[model samples]
Target: MIESWVINDDSPVPVSSAGVVEALRSRIDSGQLETWLTSSSGRLLAFVTNAERAMVVLLEGEGGPGEHAVDPGAAGSSDGFVLSNGQGDEYPDEDTVPIREAFRLVEHIVGTGSWPADARWVVDR
Candidate 1:
């Protein structure tokens, strides 16, 4: 699963990519963020919402990131429909790189840092 983190600070800290990885680790361990992976389907999803700003950042499981603005109250449905699309949305522009690539990058990044707990960790040998 590709874990998601939202940078809400108007002035984010200047840090190397390695520092970014560490920050993700901290958030994951603290339960501030969570990851969802579909083991059977090889899918990853991330959704970070800013209620105050009525913005939803949907990473769409990986290329870079996509941002959508909606009424905070309507954010749920707006975001859900986008992710549900099998192909992707035209609004984000077809030229944009596919999000699946981003998922692969996140998997690579996490594989270097830590292993996710196996979905079936206690299986009998």
Candidate 2:
């Protein structure tokens, strides 16, 4: 299970399910462009946008290929929606899931130390 998480690369801190949810909400409601969450071990990471979308990435270890969450339908649609990484970097909407969906994905990792199987994912080349 995930013992701690770092927000936007800050010092790692112990985390609870409720705390996670609260942080996400606070970031979104505050109109922040984005917020990042990374596990203490650095295996799990997530980037959430103010638009209520998030992209989660899982790393096997150093030099290992990373897997990122994907929404197949959204990815294929021509909605022109985009997500930003809060650093002037932008990505296609297909690379992220709604924040509502993110809660489950993050909670799963916190509880099982694994990404949920139900969501679609694409591995970094």
- Using TM-score as the measure, which candidate wins? 2
Lowest lDDT block of 10, candidate 2: 76-85
Listed in order, each prediction's TM-score against the native is: 0.25, 0.70
Candidate 2 local lDDT, 1-107, one digit each (tens): 43566565444675665577677666666666455566667665655553556666766655667888887767532222234433444456788777678777876
Query: Which lDDT values do the candidates have, in the order given?
Result: 0.30, 0.64
List residue ranges in candidate 2 displaced over 4 A. Answer: 1-3, 8-11, 61-64, 75-86
Q: Give the best candidate by lDDT.
A: 2
What TM-score should be assigned to candidate 2?
Answer: 0.70
Residue-by-residue lDDT tens digits, candidate 1, 32-87: 33322221122233322111111123333345433322222222222211222233
* Total clashing pairs in model 2: 0
lDDT: worst 10-residue window of model 1: 47-56
